[model samples]
Target: MAQDVLESPLVLLDEVRAGLQGGTMVPYLGPGISALREQEAPMAPEALADFFASKTTLPKRARGNPWAAAQYIESYRFRDTVTLWMQEAFAAPVPPSPFHLWLAGLSLPLIVDTWYAGEMRAALAGQSDWAEVQGITRAGIGEDRWFRFYDEEGTSIDADQAAKARTLLYTPHGCIVPEANFLISDADYVEVLTEIDIQTPIPEEVRQRRTGMSFVFLGCHFHDQLLRTYARQVMKRSSDHHYIVVDPETLTRNERRFLDEQGIIAIDMPLAEAIERLLT
Candidate 1:
């Protein structure tokens, strides 16, 4: 086993930083990375359901499912308005989280934002000229990279000129904007399998840099097979060099087994503390 197999979050963060600086670590961003203070971030599924209820009554089945709630609300009502409202809920007047600012400054070669959100992208944009490849935003950063494989398809910014700026943000689940690109129901989840082409863009430069590297999954929840898949994708190198940071409160027996099976080092701590370790 690697010497870091059982290190504390502090030590683990240090190791991760070394890999990142050495061009051997990829930081995968997720919704969990958001420190949505005073803003409407779903602390839990129920909280999201309650918030969605204010806009339109969500069926009991859709109680804990924001995607379903959002999809259902948009089906009969205004899709653009609903998605924009959800985006605004995140875009509310809150300063960027310290973790994001720290992440933006890092010279990492590549960043894979699973689903789309403009918050981190916007924050990072302030730090560097992050090229948004296949994105969905009102005003794009520049011409899309080769990763924008599908033309004018799901989450394409041109889908709606008035939708919202910096709208494309990829989460562990999928894109949060664009009603068509939304991964809400079961079909949507399965659909991601078919569209795996645009999943993770490893630029030739990034690929070379990633050799024998590790991964640090930020704002990721790894308590189930669903979220576990996110860890597997980014750490596909088949080496025991990846680590997952999840809230200790949410860690489960099943999650433990999944991590062990995948050879992943799991840190049962909150991101705030982990980031502090990295900063100091």
Candidate 2:
């Protein structure tokens, strides 16, 4: 319960330290973090418009709300353009943003992100030298599909390397191994939300093994359904976690109020700036 906890900057950092000791804290990332370097990446509104154009075979609109198109498509086409775009976007590699670098500096135990592949990998590549001990878990398609990835063909981030580095990255939604199985689409997004609801703050077993834990959230826009699902899960599970959510624009009054109310420390800064503050 947020009410039972004391909300202060120093106090919050102390809570993060406590989670480090207790191993209950974890980070839940979102799409905004991807934009840390890809400033050219289309905004959510733009992505929505593009999705509509792709679905209806209509010309892309110069200016229009993408969510409107999303609503229309959901009601009409029921296609997976939004999901496709994310998969394609993440499939390609990009440079690490500041937020990613900041994360590298922190020796947190475990990190959970909604990122697909590209930018995060880029970030990891840059931070590989500093990341002596870390673990990452991703939500893949299904348990069977995920195990197959580890079994049939191993990953570039092998278990040996992971064990040596003390890192355990996962794609709970399935990785590139079974491209088709990678969860996407509005329904897949919904499934991610469902998982957050059911099994989050991660399980206790995971926490005990993880040490110096604190969730340093980066680049995530907290309003999406998937994010909200994670937020609710985090809120319900533990108040001892640390969250540093970065956004380009400063939070609106309502947004600030909401984060303050929820006990989430919202960092109003660009991903580059956030990384600068966190890392070098």
Candidate 3:
């Protein structure tokens, strides 16, 4: 029943920066990070749902819900159709924001990106010490694997090789590059959710890296139940203290409650402003 304290951005700036530099803080990025660049890609679940709706007629109930809209498309049109649309929606290459570039320069052990965009991978292109692991859907794949590891070149690599990297980038929702692996539909999430609570779907390397590490959530909002659940499971067994940059005036009652329950301190500010301060 505790409330998350609204901390002054200036007061926590130094400590947050220090944590990033020391690799004690993991960067948890969301789709909103795409707003840093002027791109045509849908940056949020609602927007993505609209994109699907525009492509094909959707039921009124599925109009604004991405998972439902995607489910409708897969159920009616075909899973391949849904995949093609997803690939087309995120086909445009998004240039990395300054914050992403800055993070790439650091030797952080883990960075969790929940979005499907390849901006993070783009940012790390020049870094040789990093690798990525993305969550794959269980819909079409014949294998029973839940995730796949890739090197800097986008080549598939074993988990052992990924674990040896100095830095690791984890996209729990999948990514566009290398292969178009997306967990957007309800079926995709249902399959993962069944085992996520038991940590069966999470890569072993990610589990080991997240232990005892603090998280800095950038451009993320946990207003939706699905996102809240994923964030909770991903941060499970990690450090108690975490930070999320969000606008105090725009937060819903549920969002505030989620923040409080998770022991996350809220920094009231614009995402761009927060990034500028963090970079400075």
Candidate 4:
């Protein structure tokens, strides 16, 4: 089908809702989703970069880049300092949004959260059928592993154990809870990015669950190349048709191109408005 024919917001919302109820649409959440909460958690990359800069002096080139700022801190102060900052930045509790609660009720095979906050885990706390698979940084660990699995109680588990859960929460960028595992600095991503295209870093459970599923991208922006690349690789081998709720007027040229290239239908509306309609 042509992109123009699928540009109807009402029609797209109906399809997305149906997909959610039917368990074929995975929710791909971004950091901006944290903005729905009243509390502050440095939701955006730029905001996080600024937060790091505030704590330590960063060169002008790394001012607004979270990865660069983190790299600078890791190089100068040490990796422990970077982890401390991340833990402090996300220490405050952020209540889950309505969408999170709605999703928690469903029997989703997989949910990809690309941020470090613990709200998603909190939202799923009421359920016992879920587990988390997060990307781990290769800085200090002597083990040759790229990811870790944790059951609802946050105890470390094997991949076989995680695969048995009805719902799997995949955090590609790591989270603050359970353990302070973050992939923010330049060195952290160097290994993951190198193998992401080949699906080496992605867990087997995630890859199998996402095989024939569609994705509903919420609170996501693809203006940066790194963001675009991660989205592309994560959704690789999934169903062709996907939906991204975005304000058409605010899309960057690169973002628009990415949507077109990825067979994603852009629903033009505010995030809150779209979420409201999705719930209805």
Candidate no. 4 TM-score: 0.97
Better of 1 and 2 by TM-score: 1
Candidate 1: residue 259 lDDT (0-100): 65
Estimate, for each residue in 84-199, the C-alpha lDDT of model 3 and write its tens digit: 99999998877888788999999799999888778889999978799999999988689999999999989999999999999999999998998989999999999998889999
Model 1, residue 13: displacement in angstroms? 2.1
Q: Candidates ranked by lDDT, best first?
A: 4, 3, 1, 2
> Model 2: per-residue lDDT, tens digit, 1-280?
2342334434444554455345456655555666544444443434545744654654243225443454454445444544455455445444556655555445445555554443443445544431221112223323421122121223333334444443333333333323423443344445445555555324333334344444556555554444455455544534543566445255555554546555566444455554453343
* Residue-level lDDT for 179 in candidate 3: 95
lDDT of 1 at 178: 28
Error of 4 at 218 (Å): 0.3
lDDT of 4 by residue, 1-280 (tens): 2454357888888999999999999999987777866667888888899899889889998999999999999999999999999999999877788788889889799999988887788889988799999999999999889999999999999999999999999998999989989999999998889999899999989999999899999999999898999999989999989999888778888988898888888887788888999888
Task: List model 1 lDDT by residue over 57-106, tens digit each.
Answer: 77887676665676667666656655565565444433457766766667
Model 1 scores a C-alpha lDDT of 0.53
Give me the overall lDDT of model 4.
0.90
The global C-alpha lDDT for each of the candidates, from Candidate 1 onward, is: 0.53, 0.45, 0.88, 0.90
- In model 3, the runs with Cα more than 4 Å from the true position are 1-6
Off by over 4 Å in 1: 1-6, 40-47, 74-82, 91-94, 114-117, 134-187, 195-212, 247-249
Candidate 3 — which pairs collide? none
Relative to the true structure, candidate 3 reaches a TM of 0.97
**Highest-lDDT candidate:** 4
